[model samples]
Target chain A: MSHSLQHNRRLFLGALGAGLFTTRGAFAEQLLASPALTEGPFYPDQLPLDRDNDLIIINDSLTPAVGEITHLTGKILDASGKPLKDALVEIWQCDANAVYLHTADSGPKKDQQDKNFQGYGAFTTGSTGEYRFRTIKPVPYPGRPSPHIHVKVSQKGRELVTTQLFIRDHAGNLQDGVFLGLRDILDRELVVSDFEPMKNSKMGELACEWDVVIGRTPDEREFERS
Target chain B: MRRVLALSAAVAVCLPLLNSALRAQPPGAPPQGGRGAAAPNAESFLQRLMQYDANGDGSLTLDEVKDRRLHALLNRADANEDGVVTKAELTALHQKESAAIGRQPAGFPPPGAQQPPGAGRGGPPGAQPGPGAGPGPQRRGGRAGQILPEFVQDELELSPEQREQVAELQKEVDAQLEKILTPEQRALLNQPRPGGPGGRQRPPGAGPGRPNGEIREN
Candidate 1:
């Protein structure tokens, strides 16, 4: 498909998705809470110059990072399905070569690291609880089989949940111990995102939508305990 | 035609680079056995299989497939669908992986030579810091050295001295964050931490912590 056509389709879908969240607020209580997963080690020892949501390009670089460009977007919600505004959402993952932004790892493997790739990025959710990141599809690392992106959510400057998101039906996921350890099928499903090809793009860009549902708000948890 | 030639040329270059690196391993030096030590490009995958084939029969059977993941892929590795996997089949599998992953694997540095220090899950155990280790505490129990600080630093693009100053302001940051919490929330935050749940994770080759204990980036 033509690149412009696909781009338009994506924008329309993005708007539609946001609209659904707005209309579904009354039914939000029925949504499943996103399962929590370990934050994992390579969260980036050093941050890149561009902390924006677009990770494909670093601060005005013409050469884009190598990898299948993935449009990652999601919403942050509470157990009641209320969108959490002003929440900080951060994500970090390895570049196409499976190297992270951390100095210890990237320092030695600097030759292999993609200098153009912004290894880490963050975005704040607005009233819609929506966040988006243009990054590469996560690849399997040496020890870990499942390709994943580490995600952290914070509100009011306090961490809510630290988790990781996985690719749905990645062949390696079956053998991944961390993925298999999740005994609850629902929780397992929550962490995986569908990486579908954009409608008409020659570049094979992928679009992923993953909503994060925290088990409880900090205030709610504290109030319940009292 | 040009792409094929280029690809073949790249493969030709990689074979020798990997072989010489394999040969350089001192006779019987303990293999860098940890999962993080070996980079899994096409060449290394084949090299690793040979290392497992202790008898040098040039063929590997199920018994030789010690790594569970390789064992799982073993069935598919048999291109002819034969029970036994021959070097020919392994080569085909390698070719397939190279094509699918879109990586040439020719440019990677030699295995043992380019490995980052403190390679395994965090630097040698214990909180004691290693040379060049960052001022942060060593990674332990899956909670040490974090990405959040780095995220904050990068988002603000703070200078090195400013970063140090920010680190010094940890007490203030904590106080500000604490103000947002209710009394009950404060108590919960102060409670003794529980041992982290198991399910090891890392960024490609990055283990839990570095020797310098800088920030842990898992």
Candidate 2:
């Protein structure tokens, strides 16, 4: 089959599978809550001047970050599938060279940090509880085998959850100490999202969609707070 | 291209089936023998520094660095002031910085300290901060540093002293605004307003607290 023909078939099959999964109410009961992960120490101490959703470029600079460009989109939903609007979504990760924005991480190795990468970006959800960001595919550094993005969601001055998103089926995930910390396989499934290639994207840009489900009940919230 | 697409499609189709199968199994015991933190060594330090060798040369000139902060930092490492930072000079600077870090008290890995990969995830015990080490009792996600919007400062061409004064004035204005509103209304103001760009108004006194920014160790 030709490339475009194969792409169409994959899209059709993906749509069919999605439709089948949603219609089956049996799977609804198994919607695993997104487990909160450690907010790694590398969060930027002094944020960059450009704090927008597009991490690839900083403040109208023509140069882009050196990495596989990724278009990350997601929704903040409650456990019962209700959209939580007006929530703030934030993501931070190390640059392609494995240097983070935090002074603690990059201060000693400033030369290695990617200058173009914003390193951190934020988006606030509208009525649809949707958020989007343009960033690079995370790369693994020494000691941490799995490449991941750290995420935090807050609403109305109260924090909802802090978690990390992993690339689905990446071989490094098995070796990562933090990834293994989540003992439950279902919880692991909730955090991992596929970094699929964007159809017809000339830049080889990837698209990732990962929904974050906030715990609603007091009991669940207490569990997530850990 | 065809093979890659076919493989992705196969993985996509099999994923749901794999998920279902895994869901049926009981939770397995957590894995043991967590990987220890990789000790920082000189060879790795040189390898990381060489990434800036744009022309595949052994040394780095100021022009090779794109990051402004890095340019400034690397400029200081030029020991002989020859406008070029050679591998030996970088090694010397790294050793000096490492020695400085060694002298600091053990906790929180002070600002310039080297943090091992996965070190943040409870890997090393001594580096972890005690309760007393944290930034003292502040509001979670509270706007601590910033006060004036960047545009306002730029347009006014305010000096550093003037900026500080303006921040104080803004805080006073926020205090006055708080007095005007009822407690419930104040809480409503704190809620993020949805819509256009202008809609994101800084609430009274509540500057954009590091909402999705820094996750300070509590």
Candidate 3:
């Protein structure tokens, strides 16, 4: 029932946002800012040699980054808040084992879990800001107190926003400075539905859905294009 | 000799129309108003294999597969708000992704498997008389990063002279983006260009080109 209620709220909010965006202008560049990818401690040491953006990177010979396999999903909208069908959305994350592709991740091998985790994923927005991912659920580790995911939004080549996601109701949320520092609302925004047991089992069988709200449109000058 | 002349006349008459039809194909794939493809939801697969796999050794564990954290992530991912991810949802997602800072896997086609209406999609030139005439839906696809040619032009209200100043600022931003990514990511984006008039087929090694070309050409 928790999933059902959260699902309904998502539907309701999307409808409201879309209803508002539609009555205003037919071509108002989407109102929501570019979706953001949450920055994590682990990105990638160097870009993958193959660099095809495959998520699972445990085996150099094998493709697709391997991780917990979390399925991510959500929507996009305009200011008047209509679902911006066909808008673009992108995402990237630390591969499993907490290593990122950023310079900050240049530490020794002992600190890393999955040396092969490419730590990133991307998907375009459908007719709505709605997007989905077949990925591993974020895992928590030492140093960084919370588990989160990074995201980015776009239309064509222009980038809209970059942001991150936090584990809802995680005890670490309070301890993690970054997670705690977000605006009260944005922090609260992370609380999604709880992990209900899929009819199969409770441990591995889990479903999580997160919705991100950006404050601008795809063509805005304020949003960074890089 | 008379028969040869007749056959030559037939070829001369048919070739021009064929050429024109061929030229019309490039723009026809992407529908103007709206065109789309739909995919079956992977939910049932989750139910059948992952969720129902009581042993939970190799298959997706029902718990690991579903979580509130992931529920929220998925809520954000399911852009269409149709409850379940339809095939159109997958295509919509594919179209929005930029192939630069991050990208989707090559083999991971959208649910509908609407082949990219290009040389990649198995529909090479001369294979179809016109774009939309093929079996798949007319897909209005475009490249990412379709910005005005000049970086300085990005900021409005600046005089031509100030444009150069804006370019400098833009350079700073690019440099910053470069800094943010690892050496490898930068190399992927700045991969050396290929030599040719048709850079579109830049071998996968040509580096991540700005996918925005769809906007300019369309």
Candidate 4:
């Protein structure tokens, strides 16, 4: 009887701890708005017919894009830490050979571009504000020092914010003019994310998670005014 | 027994709240009131395009864009198979392009000034003193003390006042660079050119990989 009573006490304590944790989490500080970054010369001029979330596979093509495949996932949250549903998140980057899906880029360097690579893709955030993209690791262009993925968040025809994610600890980052242009150290850190190896994946794939915190969407701003 | 029941009820009440709390990513400490420069936009692009569309026809043809780079842009801007590019087409392409990238395309210099072909060129970010001392990626082979070759400047259509300003700026930059360059680098800077090196050139230093160590291969 005493042992059963002890077991009940332990369960009660565990529940109490969880309840406290949940309460603390609810009161957690507001999230930061993601830093804005310049979109460089290479966004796809003619968006490919297959503009889906999985950039690696275009429609039903068997051949995936050539590079380290990254499962990039993130949440789109507002300044108040509310998940933004129905937000459109778009990402674009160069192919394995650093070729963009643009005429100015591909026109001269057609031979180098990986024809199989979709090069750009988009995803819509669900109720949870979660989004994901399957893309190759971004590589540095010939002149641009840093390897980065361009990201844009939009809603209902209005662009909320545009930024590029940098590979954290990339040596070229220090030399990248655009990266340096970001004066705030904290804001710079916000844009740089660690692309770590996804554990237990036999295929040696990579994973990265970055939460985009936007200041105020046009809708939110309008609602507040109303 | 009564206290245990009360505790159980409290836990049940908190369970739904737990889901949202659990889903919340631990908040990052965002510094209050942080500000960054807004990304480059379309107005600047039209301004540069208008300057190049010398005839002010509200449309551009290849002949007007003297720079080979700008000519490449003209081809990309010609979205319709019709060959001639209207201002509306350029604006649409620019909007899409800028929206995709977050900023204006690189290489178009600002009004009243000209930058080397690759605007982002130079030593890595945070390099000391002279950030503008190296040949851009396009001019990887450019030498030191090389003046903008006359033809390239003509292609850029620099005003007489702008040309004089550029000349003065070039001389000052060369003198400033001379103080820091090694003798070997100095020799390379002063080396005579075999052909007319392109214009608006900066005196070249050993490029990005040197002084500040490059980020090791990831």
Top DockQ model: 4
Task: Report the CAPRI category for model 2.
Answer: incorrect
Residue A136 shift from truth in candidate 4, angstroms: 0.8
Ranking by TM-score: 4, 2, 1, 3
Summarize candidate 4's per-residue lDDT along A1-226 as a digit string, tens digits. 6964664455344433433432212312334357666556566789989899898888898987777889999888875568899999999987776567999767766776678889899999999999999988776654345678999888765576777888876655644556645433335556777788899989888998888877531111111122
B1-218, model 3: which lDDT tens digit per residue?
Answer: 99999988655543432332222121111111111211112322122123222334433222332222233433443675655543333333322322210121111123323222221112223221132222122111211221222211211212323444544555566667867889887777555334211233324433323331111121
The residue-level lDDT of candidate 1 at B97 comes to 39
Ranked by TM-score, the better of candidates 2 and 4 is 4
Model 1 Cα lDDT, one tens digit per residue, B1-218: 99999999765544433332233221111121211222233433454355455456767777765433245456668877777887667656554433332221111222321123322112222211122222222112222223234322322324334445555565466667678889898788655344222112224433212111111122
lDDT of 2 by residue, A1-42 (tens): 396466445434443343344321222222234667767767
What does DockQ give for each predicted structure?
A: 0.01, 0.01, 0.01, 0.02
Which ten residues in a row are the worst by lDDT in model 3 chain A?
A217-226
lDDT (10s digit) by residue, model 1, range A1-226: 4864664454344323322332212222234445455555567777777899999898888998877799999888764567899999999987777578988667766776777779899999999999999998887554345678889888777666677789976765543445544432334556787888978879788998888876421111111122
Per-prediction TM-score, please?
0.45, 0.45, 0.37, 0.48
Alpha-carbon shift of residue A64 in model 2 (angstroms): 0.5
- When 1 and 4 are scored with TM-score, the better candidate is 4
Ranking by lDDT: 2, 4, 1, 3
How much is A217 displaced in model 4, in angstroms?
10
Interface RMSD of each: 25.1, 21.4, 24.3, 20.9
- Better structure of 1 and 2 per TM-score: 2
- Name model 3 segments beyond 4 Å from true: A1-54, A57-67, A85-88, A103-107, A110-116, A185-187, A190-205, A217-226, B1-218
